[model samples]
Target: METGFPWGSAPSVDLSLWRADAIVLFDWLMSTDLNAVPITHPAQKQALADLLARLEEVGITESTEEEIAAPRKMWQGHGLGGAPIDQSSVTRAQGSMTQDIT
Candidate 1:
């Protein structure tokens, strides 16, 4: 649906979906940080919950503290809340300079 906000303005949305659709949605989400937001659809929330559960099952949810710390330092140094930025907030300004989606 066309977002009614002004041209180039943030979109407002609401939606729902099933498990398979939720998987794809969450996969997109894992690429972002949860703190940032114009707000993802509610389906995105359910999808993320599901994805986290799957990660727990696969053992990827458990990370070595040291391993996690290295990236944390790098992200802070780069001036991101941590690299991946915030999931809900699209770092559009960052993108204008970096040309990287993440």
Candidate 2:
């Protein structure tokens, strides 16, 4: 469906983006932020939820600390609320750039 806000001036949305990624359409979803105005259609809501669940299950966007930290010989003894991430891995993931979606 073509979409625009009531105030006008915003560009129309091409919802073909839903098919862009079998994994996750981070490109069109504002880098996977999903901060847009709600799509009120029930089917749209359900589809979105299903897609999110699939992504989380496969660990693409949702992964345990071990999956992330242990892969690179960066595991240190527990500290700072975590196993003290190595400076190398620390650089890969900054605090402000990460989010806990699960």
Candidate 3:
């Protein structure tokens, strides 16, 4: 088995050696270390763009300009205030009786 660079080894020029090397590239991308290695190949960039276009066709793409906005229903009076409570008050009055005790 051949060993690659150290923990922070620089990027290799060979793309054929990349399946394993790409992992290191991903680590760099996550750490905001843009200078370590360049993974900006033309083919990779095109592939990513194609994937994003397909996702947009299914409405999964995130874009601020063409966002789907819907009117939010106001729930201010969706509870008892929106319902009729007069019948309940009448029923309570009819169920009660005045009792006298000496």
Name the top TM-score candidate. Answer: 1
The segments of candidate 1 whose C-alpha lies over 4 angstroms from its true place after superposition are 1-40, 79-102
> For candidate 3, lDDT tens digit of each residue in 18-99?
1112232333334453343446675665444443333344333332321212101222233456754365643453344321
lDDT, candidate 3, residue 86? 60
TM-score head-to-head 1 vs 2, winner: 1
- What is the model-wide C-alpha lDDT for candidate 2? 0.43
Please give, for residues 1-102, the per-residue lDDT of candidate 2 as tens digits: 232335665453322211113223332332454446487776686566555654454444544445444433433454558665566655564334332232
Model 1 residue-pair collision total? 7
| Candidates in order: C-alpha RMSD to true structure | 13.5, 12.1, 26.6
Those runs of model 2 whose alpha carbons end farther than 4 Å from true positions after fitting are 1-40, 62-102
- Put down candidate 1 lDDT per residue, 1-102, tens digits, no spaces: 333333565543444333232333434456667656345596665555555555444444354555445334434634335345553333432233221110
Provide the lowest-lDDT 10-residue window in model 1: 93-102
